[model samples]
Target: MSTQGLERQTRNYLSNNVPQIQQHGGNFEIREVDEEAGQVTVAIGGACSGCGIAPMTMKAIEHRLPESVDGVSEVKVVRAGGPRAAVMPSKIDEMDEMEEYEDYDPPF
Candidate 1:
């Protein structure tokens, strides 16, 4: 798949899933996407930054965005930090955390 195709897919996926994201007062903007490499980077803006639901928004995007689109092995979110890098967490590290919690016995 070409980069353009991947970007298009990512856009479509966002549009289709925007409602869900918006319901939580969050939004995402595509920065760049590479199809062959299956990499996508997006920016989260608006109320998402200060929202306590930010984690949910991030988790939802990380889990659903790639599955919703083709040729996307992973998704990266970037918070608007001007010239500096985005404030989003590393995808690999986030995935590792998710995996760690996937199977567990809560000591409640």
Candidate 2:
């Protein structure tokens, strides 16, 4: 099949079979599709950036894409920005300040 056809098939397979991706506010982008090598590169983006389950998601894609998409012998899934460190209030004063905003309505 042509490179474009393979890419479309891969995308369709993901869209239809992978519900978790979209359910978690995440999306995958086909970064590269090498027809001769039968390799595909996919990047997970959006809320998946710092998601704990991202590694499992990638593994699932790597394992399943090739089985479902014709001409795809290998799959590589990566995060768009990698995982991010979560930030939180570390002190009581900061926590109080945060609580203050809980009831403050925005002007907008």
Name every residue pair that clashes in candidate 1: none
Write model 2 residue lDDT over 1-108, tens digit each, in one string.
889998999899888888777887888889999999999999877766555555566767788789888899999987665343222214322533444434443211
lDDT of each: 0.64, 0.72
TM-score of each: 0.65, 0.73
Could you give candidate 1's per-residue lDDT for residues 4-89 as a string of tens digits? 88888887877666665556555678888776679899877655554444455565677777777877888887564443322344
TM-score of 2: 0.73
Top-lDDT structure, candidate number: 2
Error in Å for residue 16 of model 1: 1.4
C-alpha lDDT of candidate 2 relative to the true structure: 0.72
For model 1, the superposed segments whose C-alpha errors exceed 4 Å read 20-26, 82-108
Cα error, candidate 2, residue 32 (Å): 0.1
